[model samples]
Target: MIPATSSTPPLAELRGIGKTYGTGEHAVDALVGADLAIYPGEDMIIEGPSGSGKTTLISILGLLLRATTGSIRIGDREVGQLGERDLPALRAKTFGFVFQGFNLFPALTALENVALAIRMKDGKAKDPEGQARALLERVGLGPRAHHLPADMSGGQKQRVAIARALGGDPPILVGDEPTAALDTKTALSVMELLRGLASEHGRAVVVVTHDPRLERFADRVVRVEDGRIESNLPRLAQAS
Candidate 1:
């Protein structure tokens, strides 16, 4: 176990992280001593080919996976040793996630979907419906708040997903190939929305994608290859 420190104040930190699958001769190293730090309002893009541990890194960062041998910290809290039951609260309070597939309920309206996330975080919060409606409006989905996922277009569905992810007002947003099925223009629009969330709202946004065009919207682009960070570079900010 790595020694815990109290100096660093990043939103997320990974130190000497390593993950392996299988055993003996069949062992596959997914991550090898990977270290990363993300601060608030940072829009980071992780780029790499398939099977390069990009997803593994995102899963660990999002608290969905544990490192086999390393320390992970979210804010000042050390999460590398937390129990499974404790993870949900941390995830709900600290991070929002948007996936390639819009994981919205087909039968539920957009408003309901967003409200469900809020209710999951705080079952006793009282007026979750009203809060969800406001979030939908904030995401420019007010007109279609009553429409189900089936009734919305791909972009609209993604927007609704964004709204749902923001239900708890998390400080960090994690997205995994969120633009996979969208057209180039739509993908750019989604990237813009994510960037806006980081810059305008001061949320740390981390995106894992293979799209090179997305570098345009990233504040920092960290390329991963063979379970390691090959390069990390900063990019010019897009004008609002």
Candidate 2:
């Protein structure tokens, strides 16, 4: 379903999405008629309790999982029906993901980590090292470019992870529990960095986290309970 009001079309959208595990009497409905729209330059937060199905929702949004019903629309295309061969390229181009764990190689330096991501995402990357350093600098880690993850503080290591996520400049940045491992202050710092990416860099930031402290940074806060979007703050944030 297309958004009715036209400020900007959604970068990605979920329409009547549903996901079920198993079948028959043993089936579990992880998501039920869930719908959402992600827009550029917006910071969206998805928060829910342990079994609220937020993770399944995000997995589908990132193209890592397919829905049993409805559409997963990215830009002008409906990706739900796309074949496996067609999904990798589309997922790579549309979203950059940041996992709960930093997910960096212990041996790779900050610069190397980002550079490797650039090369992996775009095999034809020109001057990968140069681009990597610039990304590190963008995340305020320029001087630590050569340092390995073990040598850096938690915040610094998370910065490197964020820089790596920016490699291909995907329109959407998806973070799953991005700050779960950090201390309070450090987590806020990392969240601020993410907020800047949406506010200053015009990238759509979609974060699935249970931390209530992070709510202040979002333009829209979506709460999922019992597999449905219970509420979306500031109703005008998107076209329903």
Candidate 3:
């Protein structure tokens, strides 16, 4: 089902999405008829309890998994029915992902981590070090560029992760529990950095986290429970 095109269409749209595991009495519905529209220049937060299917929802959004029903559109392209071979190109080109655990290579330094991402996004990246250092500097990690993940604090490691995610200049940034491992101050700092990036580039930022502290940073807060969205509302900042 195609949605009517708007002057500025959503970076990604999820309509009547459903995801189920198993079958018969043993079946578990992880998501049910979920509808969401993520736009550029907005930071959207999806929060809920541990079993509320937040991760499942993000998995589908990142193209790491498929919905059982309904359609998903990235910009104007409907990707729900796209074949496996077609998904990697679109996902690499459109989405950048950061995870709860810093998924950096243990052996690689921060600069190497970001450079690898640049190479993955564009096989022929010119001066990968130049691009990597610029991204690290953008994330306020220029001084830590040569540091290994083990040598940096959690926040710094996450910063490297974020910089790596930005390698392709993806239109959408997807974070699953991005700040979960950081302390309060660090988490807020990370959130501020993410918000600033999204605002500056008009890119969409989607985060699936259970931290209530994150609510204040979101333009829209969505609550998911029992495999369904309980509420989706704009925060005061966006409402004004």
Candidate 4:
């Protein structure tokens, strides 16, 4: 894994993180003793096989789920110290999410979809439609702005999803299996866009993926297995 160029403190930090589901003997540990630091403007990728707890780690980092044990620090504030009511607000302001399914509404045009997210993120957005158009343009989807997701290709749909996620300019952009559905070429294109989010926009980008081919775009790569992060991970190479 490559180290970040910045000498600044971590934007988000996790220590001794553990997670469990259910209770009693039925409990299953999804993650254990995971220590991670997300630096600003870094593109980090989390990789693991099926049931390796990679997704769980991303969830905890994105504040989508609570850790059963460990300290989660976002900036100077501890996650545990924040009230339940504050979580949604904090998550909205701190992270933008992209998922494998694209998550675009079939009924809405690409511009409408992005505009909706902008309004949802900041109800007082000065000009949501104009900002939405600019976002679509940024993702190279300006021509498809009026088209519904059903009329778009998989890559186009994902780009629209990315545009929507870019709303509010969240500091951290989290992606879960974002390229699992794309062909190799399209996947690389999307990964490049994600990497640009970190390098060009100064936002931290964290993605959970099973593809080693995507590692070249990452500044840091983490491997997890059996609920624990491997200490000495092999260097990423071209994988079949």
Candidate 4 residue runs with Cα over 4 Å from true position = 1-6, 231-240
Model 1 compared with the native: what TM-score? Answer: 0.92
For TM-score, candidate 3 versus 4, the one ahead is 3
Lowest lDDT 10-residue stretch of candidate 3: 1-10
Error of 1 at 105 (Å): 0.6
The Cα RMSD in angstroms, rounded to one decimal, for candidate 1 relative to the true structure is: 4.7
Runs of candidate 3 with Cα error greater than 4 angstroms are 1-6, 237-240
> Each model's TM-score?
0.92, 0.93, 0.94, 0.93
lDDT for position 105 in model 3: 98
How far off is model 2, as Cα RMSD?
3.1
Clashing pairs in 1: none
Q: What lDDT tens digits, residue by residue, belong to model 2 across residues 38-155?
A: 9878888899998899889999999999889989899999895678999999998988898889989999999999999999999998999999999999999999999999999989
Best by TM-score: 3
Candidate 2's C-alpha runs over 4 A off are 1-5, 235-240
Worst 10 residues of 1 by lDDT: 1-10
